[model samples]
Target: MTGLLRAEWTKFRTVRGWVLGMVLAALIIVLLGVFTAANNYSSCEGPDGDDCPAVPLGPDGSAVNDRFSFAHQVLDGDGEVTVRVASLTGTITYPPPDHDKIVPGVVPWAKAGIMIKESVRQGSAYAAMMVTGGHGTRLQHNFDGDAAGSPGASWLRLTRAGDTITGAESADGVRWTTVGTVRLAGLPPIVRVGLFAASPCDLTVTQGDLGGTIGKCRLARAVAAFDHVSLAGNPWTHDDVGAMRGAPALSQGAFRESGDTFTVSGSGDIGPYGLEGGQPVERTLSGAYTGLIVVIVVAVMFITAEYRRGMIRTTLLASPRRGRVLVAKALVLGAVTFVTALIAALVAVPLCRRILRGNGNYLLPVSTATELRVVLGTAALLAVAAVLALAVGALFRRSAAAVITAITVIVLPHVLATASVLPVELSQWLLRLTPAAGFAIQQSVPEYPQVTGHYVPQMGYYPLPPWGGFGVLCGYAALALGLAVVQLRRRDA
Candidate 1:
């Protein structure tokens, strides 16, 4: 087994053309991923009142939406804060297409309520208890923890004990129901605790009968009135002394406090935006994933090239066990491609962000762990696809035939599903059942029911869980490898 594996690896590395093809695959991943992200710049609005015009976002920008607004006060040390939210309301404003400018519609994941943040800075560590315009009550902490559908309690509280914060909700502020708990490590002695509002304006455009989501968007404002105001910390002095009393920014929007009543309103995003950069940052390989075409090519050639050059006979003679020989080849291909693709994915993610920032645009918020998964998982994704391609190539044993079949069977389905070329349902099934399911590995933002967006593949949303999708891809590769082994034993070398 070891000898057979060594022989296959030697043959693969010794051929300069094959080595160059592998290098080309990595270069393609980086160049395509980074340059595509660099060219796309996304600017979001908070208090500025700016928004994305109803224009097409080309290929890279359509699936991204990350904007929100927040208003908070800094409090020193650990203490409890509770507030009764009288109402949570929002309105979606269409920009002049229809005569009716403001529509009574709440975007999915429109959140308004109380929160405790390590800082007011975007992407800082925080925990929130919010009432969605539609999805009921939720207790979300940081970028990943979400405890949604907690009985629609209007009065929310965040009690901190050292690094741990417990989120509780109540109907009357008397009976508190524990919703969730989270630990914010290195929480500064002083932290921001107050009200916030945000909405992800998913722009759904209806062209005649077909309603296709053109942009993951936001063009709305969420307003909430909080009374029964209570605090256990120092009174947060809001600065803006010379800005006048009736500033529209303060009167109609932002935060206004009078006695025990506080009205908070904002427009922008709060939660961590889904995987990839919200609007500005394109992470999931964007054009770089097209480089998988090169990866597939190299993968198919891994075996077909041997068959084309009549080297199969020598390979079989060197390793008499046909099944063992196939396994060795698969192992070699999977390992090498895994390393190459991993390097490409890691390089592409950070580089893409740098380029996007260079253009004065910022990526949506995502956790450090999620970032790691995207980079590492993309590599795993490519490795799995490459192995699957190799197995399919072995089954066909013809370079052209294998390459064409692999593309038709694997690559096309992903492109059609991910690019919105097919119906969302059909695309989801294709991803669920096909090797292209491997792409789920790179998804950093998980689909939350509370958050509304196109959870379909075209918008980079995967129906299957990341590991689950990857598992399905692996299953197909395993099945293909099994069939290839059987064929190698029966068919002439």
Candidate 2:
């Protein structure tokens, strides 16, 4: 096996064209990545023509929206905050056919009720038991965790003991059921417990005349009236966490108090940042798609060229075992592709990200671990794709036919799915079943069912989870390799 591998590696390296082709693939990845980043720009000017503030980062280091209205009082230690949500109402701007008026309505996921937070700062640790406009009662914590309770429960409570917080909800305030319990690690001794309300922007997606999706987001706000506010402390203080500067007076966050009733009005969301107003880290790696094509061509030719020149007979005689010869070639091709692509990806990601930030674009923040996954995953994707192409080349023994077959299964599906030419459902299915599923490994932004947005392939959402999709592609490659092995063994050299 060692001798066979050495022979295959020697053959690949001695061929100047093959070595140059690998170099060209790496160059394409890095050059196109830098070009894409340099060309992309974003303008988020405030009402006064100044640059907008940076997006907030959650505790987990992902971009998050934490704007809301809070009517809170400081709690010294273990305590409980409870309130009855009387009603939830909101106004939508330019909804649908009439794009000229502000109408009274609540978008699904508008939230209001009681919360126990470490502080009033945006993206702070906290747990909230709230009633949403359409999702009913939910216990949400730290920008990502959510637990559903009884539907349409009007009363909510959050009790904090040490670092653990328990959320319970009730319909009449007499019969209560525990919604959820979460531990807010490192919560300070003094915390803010209060009544809060928030709503995300209203999203409208329509079909374009040319078989594409058109999406628009309009500003929206939610108002919730809470009665029987139960908390013991100083006079209630109101703050709009992460408030937008110079926003319209009607959309600004504020709270009104009358006796024991507190009415809070707020805008923005409290969850994962969806597909809007930011560029993901993977955006810088857009060149991977183009580089994969080059890799496919090179890998197919590596094997098919041997067949065309009638070198396979001599190669099989030298090895005596055809399967081992195929494996040796695949190993050499896969290793060279992986190493070249890895070097290109490592240079492209950070360099392009800096360029993106320099161009005034709000690059979505991701953790170091996630960024590493994206980079390594991209290299793996190219390597596996090359292996698949080699297997197809061995199966067909024709470079053009093999290259076409590999690209159609691996690249075309991704293009059609992400280009918005097909319906979202069909696009998702294509990503799921085809070798293009491997592209899911590059998705940095995740789909949160709690956040209301178009989770479509066109918007960078994949149907399968990252590793799951990669496994599908690997399965196809393995099957192809097995069939190629059988054909090589059965046919005369």
Candidate 3:
């Protein structure tokens, strides 16, 4: 295997043209990363208040997402509650382009349903079966798991049987599917259990708005109309946790009753804060993915060129085990791309910080550790993409076709997702399923339920966690490599 690898390396390095292609990939990443970071500028000013709207930054200085809306009534003892959500619609009031009026836009992840909370303190353990604006039905619990379910389920039922609380969603009200169960330990008899709605979006600051020079991250609110709500065993009572109407943090949220049904409109934040102001969306390493195009093109050409120039026979002759030849080539391609991309990203990220701060643009808070992750993740993403393209090139053995396939399959999805070319649902799926998921590795800021802006693709926030998203791309590479090896073993080079 070592001999086979050495032979592949010798063939690759001896070619000056291919060497230059690798050089170009590195230069592209560095150049674009720097240029985009420098050019993308922003600024922010006020939101005058004591608990003034702040970018949720942790001890590490990266964004600490916190925001959501909760409308509920306190239940003093353990019991079960069941409700049918007729429909869930989410709303965000954006600062108008002219700053004269409030513009309303539908929010993604806008949720309406029944919840049982340990407290209204935001971060307390909770569970719910909900119907979202764009994500369909979900059985979300805790802080991170936004668990998915079959579409169009209308009934949300939560029952506290002893210490374990179980949530279920039913298509017909009679037949139910268990979303999950959670034991909110230290079992308090009383809990805040009722309807809730939340949305996170950016309140756009106009060109000369006084309240904000750039943005004041505003929380989103979801609304649900229920045909019926029954707390099977007890009487429900209103509990504000002591915040008066129009409180600074609560922001004018209220609940009302209309006949047997109830309507709740509340504003506050729950979960991670999606807050950043005056910070340019294009932070360091913006537009870095454009360089992956060149990396993939070069990587595809690496193998396709071998076949085109009739060098595959010579490659196989040196290593009679044809599968070994493919593995060696993939390792060589992935390693070279990783090094080149790493150097490029390291140089570009620092330059971006310098230029952005020089322009007086406030960047989203980032820790030193987060910075390292972003830089390394970019290189890893590029390395994986290069390997994917190389594998595809092996399968097809056609330079033009493989290059086209690589760009179309891997590159275009990222572009469409970033641009938010389609509906949010479709855009998210594109990133989740495609090789473009690799871009999540470079997501510097996280999506906070407390803040909403243009939650589209180009903002650099992703629906998947960094490594989780990158894993999708890696999966593609692994599958393609496996297939390419099989083909190499069976077919003539």
Writing each residue's lDDT as its tens digit, candidate 1 over 243-282 gives 2233334113466777777777765554434444453233
Look at candidate 1 and tell me the lDDT of residue 367: 53
Per lDDT, the best of the predicted structures is: 2
Decide which is better by TM-score, 1 or 3.
Answer: 1
Candidate 1 least-lDDT 10 residues: 55-64
In TM-score terms, candidate 2 sits at: 0.96
Reference-based lDDT, residue 91, model 2: 89
Query: Candidates 1 and 2: which is better by lDDT?
Result: 2
* Model 1, runs deviating above 4 Å: 14-16, 30-82, 105-108, 117-126, 160-163, 186-212, 216-218, 231-263, 275-290, 305-311, 339-357, 361-376
Candidate 3 per-residue lDDT, tens place, 1-493, comes to 8887787788778888878887887777677767776776554434442333345443233443334445566777777778888766544554446333344444556666788877765356677777776676776665544667667888888888656788788888899898777766665677788887655443554322322123365545556677668854445554443233344432444566677777655444334433244453335665566778888888888898878889888878877988888888889888888888888777776777788778656667656666678788888888989989999999999988899999998989888766634555667888899998888887766665423454546455677998899999999999999999999888877
TM-score of each: 0.77, 0.96, 0.61
